[model samples]
Target: MLRLRKSILTVLLAVFTLLGCVAGPSLSAEKTALVVSVPMEGVVGVSLENYLDEAFAYAAEEKAALVVIGLDTPGGLVTSMRGMSQKILSASIPVAVWVGPPGARAASAGAFLVMAAHVAAMAPGTNIGAAHPVTASGQDVPDKELSRKITNDLAAQMRSLAEERGRNAEVAASMVLNSVSLTAREAMEIRVIDTVTPDLPSLLKWADGRKVRVGTVDVVLDLKRYEIRTFEMSPRLRALHFISRPDVAYLMLTLGILAIVFEVLTPGGFVMGTAGAVMALIGAYGLRMLPFNWAGIILLVAGIIVLVLDLVVGGIGVLSLFGLASLVVGSLVLFRAPGGELLNVSVGFMAGITLTLGAFFILAAGAVWRSTRNRVTSGQEGMVQGEGVVVEDLAPGGFVSCHGEVWKAVSEGGERISKGTRVRVVRTDGLLLHVRKVEGENLEEKGAGHK
Candidate 1:
C-alpha cells in the first residue's frame, strides 16, 4: 500500500510540471512592457494635434515605457507645430522622434519636432533642416527690420530647444535663418541627432539602456522584450487630415460652391443644398487651418458672387467671362507654403473643374431659366375674368365649368345666373372659386363664350 501511494504522487508531480511549463508565460508573474508608435507625417494640422493628444494619453493609460513617433513631412503650420512641441515637452513617457526609411525627411516644423524629442533618431539617406521662415509666396522677411525680428525670434526658439536637449544650437538656428539642409550622416556628424538607426528594432535596441528626462523626471527606457503597438489615426481624424491639405481643401471649396450655385439656379433641391452646405463648411474649416492667402480667397469669393449676380440681373455671358478669369487667376495663387512653393495640384486639374462648373451655370442654368419663362397655360387660381359656363343654376354657391373641369364656385357680385350664363373666374380660395357672369358673353344659345 505504501509503494502504491508513492507511485501516485510521482505521477501527479510530473503532470503538474508539464502544465506549468505550458502556462508560465501566460501567468501574471512578470510586468508587461508596452511601447506605442504614432505616425507623424504630412502637414501637422489640428487633426494631427488631436491625434498626438490621444496617443500620448494612451501611453499613460497603457503604462507604456516608450512612445515612438515615425516622422516624414514637410513643414506645416507654426501653431500646430508649437502645440505638438508643448505636448512632447510635457509628456510623462519618454518620446522618441524617428525620421525613417531612407530618403524621407523631417524638414521645417519637422526639424523642430525632432529637436524637441528625448531621442532624436534618423534612418540612413534621410535628411533634416531647411527651417527657414518664409511667406506663402516663399519670400523671406520683407525688410531688414522685419527679418531681424523673425530671425531673432526663431533663433531664440531653436536655441531653447537645443539647449534643453544638449544638441548643436547654432546649427539648428542656422537651419531656420539660412534654410540649410543636411543628410542623416551629416546631421549625426554635426551632433544634430543622437543616432542614425535603419529600422525600429535597431532603434529600440540602441535605446534600451538610454536615460531620458521627461517633465522634470529622469527615467530609463525599458524596451527589452516589449511589444510595440501601432496606433493609427482614427477615421474621423483621417478624414479631417485628408481635407486639411491645401489642394484637397481648395478642391472641396470649389466643388461645394458650384453645388450651392447649382441649387440656386435649379431651385427645390434639398439634397444639393444640404450636401453643398456641409462640404462648404468643412472646406472653409480646412482653409482656416492651413496657411492660405486670404487675398486669393477673397478674389475667389468675389468671382463666384459676380457670376451669380450676372445670372440674376441678366447678361450675355460678359460678366461670366470676367468672373471666370478672376476665378482662374485666384485659383492659381490661392496658396503657397511659407517656402514660396505652391501645392502639387496640377493646373490642368483647376482648369477642368473651372470649365465644368462654368458650363453647368451657363448652359444648364440658362436652359432651365428659359423653360420657366414660356407661359402659364394651366391654373385654378388667378382666373378672374376668365370665361366659364355656369354648369348649375347659381343662387349663391353652385358648380361652374372652367378650364375643362367643373368648380364649386360662388358669385362674386352675388347675382343670380341661369345655367346657360357664361361666367368668368374672379379668384379661388382653396377648391372654391369666386366667379362672376361675363358681360355680353352669352351670345350663342349655350356654347358661345367670349372669343
Candidate 2:
C-alpha cells in the first residue's frame, strides 16, 4: 500500500514538471511590443488621419508596452500634422517616434509629431525641426493677422506636447515660430529628443530602462526581450495616400475636364457622359479639399465653355484664341500660395496641360469645319436633270416617282400630262416638282403617246 501511494505521487510530480517545461518561458515572456513605422514619404494630406487610426488600433489590441513610430518625412498639411500630434498625446501606450536610417528628417509637421511622442528618439544622421507653414503653390501666405494667429496656435500646441513629454518646450516652440532645426546629436543635447540611437537594436535597448506613463499609472518598460510587431496601412488608406498626391490630383482634374469635353461633343452617349460627370465631381471634391484659388477655378471653367461655344458657333478662331489665353492664366493661378512641403503643380505642368488642351480643341474645330463644307449627296437639289415616272394623271399637274419616292408634279408649259408618262424635272418648290416633256416629245405628243 505504501509503494502504490509513492508511485502515484511520483507520476503526478513528473507530469507537473513536464507541463511547466512546455509553458513556463512563453507565459513569462511579454507579448505586447508593437512598433508602428509611419514612413510618410509623400505630401501630408487627410490620409494621415487614417494611418494614425490604424496604428492606434493595433496598439490598443496588443496592449502594447510601447508603440514606436519610425518616421521619415518632409512634412505635410498643418491640419493633418496637428491631428496626428493630438492622437499621439492621447494614446494609451507609450509612443516613441524615431527619425531613422541615416539622412532622415522630421521637418515641418514632422517636427510637431516627433515632439509629441512620449519618448522622442533619432537614428544617426537624422534631423528634426523646420516648421514653416506655406500654401500649396510654394508661395508664402501674406495675411499677417491670420499668419500670426496660426503661428501662435501652433506654438502653444507644440509647447504643450513638449512639456507633457518632458522635452524642451522652448526649442519646440521655436521650431514653429523661428523654423529652427537640429541634428540627432544636437537635438539630444538640447533636450528636444530623448536619445540618439544608431539602429533599431540600440533603440529597443535604450527604451528598455525608460519609464513611461499610461493614464494615471507609470509603467517601467521591459522591452529587452519583447517581440516587435509592425502595423501597416490598410488598402483603403493606401489608395487614399496615392490619390492625395498633388500630381495625382492634378492629373485627375485634367482627365475629368477632357472627358467632359468629349462627352459634350458627342451627346446621347449616356455612359460616356455619366463617367465624365462622375470623374469631374470627384476631381472637384479633391480640388476643394486642397488649397486652391476660386478665381482660377472660375476662369478655367469659363475658358472651357468658351472653347466649346466656338465649336457650336463658328467664331473664325477669335474665341478660340481668347479661350486659350484664359486657360493659361487660370492654370497659373489654380493653386494658392505655397511654400511648405505640400505637393504643388508646377507652372511648367500648367503650361503643358493648357497647350495640349488648346491643340486638341483646335484640331477638333478644323475637323468640324471640313465636315460642314461637304457637298450634298441625296436631296431635291441633288436630282436636277434626273429621270422620273408619272404616278397619277393630271391636266398641267400630276404625281411622279423620283428617287424611289413619289412627288407632286406640274407641267412647266401648262400642258396636260397623263399617268405612266415619263418626264424631266425642270424645277422644284417645297415637295412640288415642275416637269417638261421628254426630249423630242412635245406635251401634246406625250399625251397622244400615252393615250
Looking at model 1, residue 351 earns an lDDT score of 74
Q: Give the top-scoring candidate (lDDT).
A: 1
* TM-score of each prediction: 0.67, 0.69
Question: Largest TM-score belongs to which candidate?
Answer: 2
Counted clashes in each candidate structure: 2, 5
Which regions of candidate 2 deviate over 4 angstroms?
1-39, 181-185, 268-271, 285-296, 311-321, 324-351, 359-451
Backbone clashes in model 1, listed as residue pairs: 138-340, 384-425
Candidate 2 lDDT, tens digit per residue, 1-451?
A: 9999999999999999999998888777655455554555555567777788887887788677778878887777676776788788888888888888888888878888898888889988989987755555555457887678777887898899898888899998998788898999999999999999987778889889678876677877877676676677778877777766555666677667767876888687778777767767766766654566777777787888777777877555567788888877777667663323333345566677788878877877777777678764479875567678777775788788888888888988888877666788888887888887665554445677789
Model 1 agreement with the true structure over 306-395: per-residue lDDT tens digits: 677667766656677778878877876676434232123345776787787677557644665675676645776336557788888789
lDDT, candidate 2, at 324: 87
Which parts of model 1 have CA positions greater than 4 angstroms off?
1-32, 137-148, 291-296, 308-318, 328-451
